[model samples]
Target: MITAENLTKRYGKTLAVDALSFSAPRGAITAFLGPNGAGKSTTMRMVMGLDRPSRGSALIDGKRVQDLPAVPRTVGAMLEMGNHQPRMSARAYLGWQAHSARLPRTRVSEVLELTGLASAARRQVGSFSLGMRQRLGIASALLGDPENLILDEPINGLDPQGVLWVRSLLTHLAAQGRTIFISSHLLAEVEAVADRIVVIGRGRLITECSMAELRERAGTRATIVSTPDAKKLVRVLREDGAQVESELSAQEVVRVFDRSASQVGEMAAEHSLRLHGLLQEKVTLEQAFMELTAGAVEFRDGGQEPSATAVPSAMSDGDPQ
Candidate 1:
């Protein structure tokens, strides 16, 4: 297991990471999510021992990555792909790293095939497209086939096919009992692939929860009703302990927020109310995220709007595709 105990990182006066703590256990995909400049990259860098933390520390098993018996063979990571050499082929680069790590040299070819880079193995990494470079970087991370995979935005530059391939590969690795820790801005993508999520904002841990637990805890299953007698319906629903809001352009058509569609249906039937429309509406990931991170936001409570015509309501984390 990879665990962090009060992990904190400071750069001069700015604390890039606060006292955050979480774990990535074997046999699970733990998603790390945050906004831009939210200290996600900094935390990952600290975990990989690329930068020493000003306070606190991260460890794999019982030892820090810096104190591990073997460095690259214990943890494999793909942070950014811009550090590739200009003249080296993907195969050559990966093979060289694998050999240096004393891993089976044949594992290089395996990683190339696994990342779907076999066709581009002989191409110079510098001449490759952003998507190809991303794949090659992932290939290098998997060269040693380490027990842990810490990928930051692993799908940053990829075609639909490549994205699917990476998703499948990660899911498969997690099923094999390898710890898969990933950081991403795409909530819906992680919803499909990850078993647990560790959400942070402004350099602090917001919530660490399983997908099902988050859905149950944060997401509200609401019943949306549109009726001609909006005011009357709202009055009736409100009498039944359901939260009603304003959503009418004309006379009396109201939107009610109830815990369940069945509850609304039962109340409507009891009151003998004629409903024009009633349906269940799920609170999406972005909506839940907005609620989850409301307190963590810096300028939201302040009187500054990013724009005059910007969206008044928050955005939900869904339907990124």
Candidate 2:
């Protein structure tokens, strides 16, 4: 397991990470999430021992990363993808890395194939596309055959097929009891694979919980009803303590918040209302993420503050830091 206990980092007077703490457990994929400039990279650097933490500690299996007997074999990290030599072939790069880490030369070929870069292994790094470079980076990370992996934006320059392949690979790795911790801006993909999430804002821990718990606590489930008597149904739902919004378009759809489809249907029946259709709208992961980090956004489009009501009480990890 990878654990951070009150991890903090500072650059002169600027505080990059502040009293942050979270865990990425084995056999599960944990997503590290935050808005831009929220200190996610800094925190990850501290965890990997690339940067010294000003306070607290980051541990891997109860020991510091630097203290590991074989650091590369214990934790393989891909913090960035552009650090490789441009003039070197992909195969040559992996071979050099494996040699430095005292790994078998055959392991280099294995990872090249595993990351789907075997066909491009002979190509120079400068001649490869962004997607190919990404694959090469992943191959380098897997070259050590580490038990834990930490990746930052592993899908930054991939096409749809590449993205799907990465999703499958991460899932397969986690199923083998390897700890996978990744930071990415793609909430849709994160939602699809993450078993839990650790969200931070302004370098502070906002919340950390299972995906199921996040949905149960902060997800908004709304009921959508299509009815000819939209006005009447809106009034009925409002009187029943449900927040209702009616769209008086050709379809005459009404959205009722904090109510289930069955509840809305029973209410409509009680009011003798004619309904064309009723369905429940499950809140997307993006919606929950926005609400949880509304107040923590470092930048705004129009220099406007976020709505106070945008953050729900249940979503708050604790009293604001």
Candidate that would win on TM-score: 2
Q: In model 2, which runs have C-alpha deviations exceeding 4 angstroms?
A: 229-232, 269-276, 303-321
Task: Report how far residue 303 has shifted in candidate 2, in Å.
Answer: 5.8
Per-candidate TM equals 0.82, 0.89
User: In lDDT terms, how accurate is model 1?
Assistant: 0.77
lDDT of 1 by residue, 75-148 (tens): 89987658888699988888788878888888988988888889888988889998888888888888777889
The sequence of per-residue lDDT tens digits that candidate 2 reaches over residues 197-316 is: 999987789999999999889656778999999999999888878898889999999998889898999988998999999988887789988988876876579987644422221111
Q: Per-residue lDDT for 122 in model 2?
A: 89
> After best superposition, candidate 1 residue 118: deviation in angstroms?
0.7
| Residue pairs in collision within model 1 | 230-252, 286-316, 286-317, 287-316
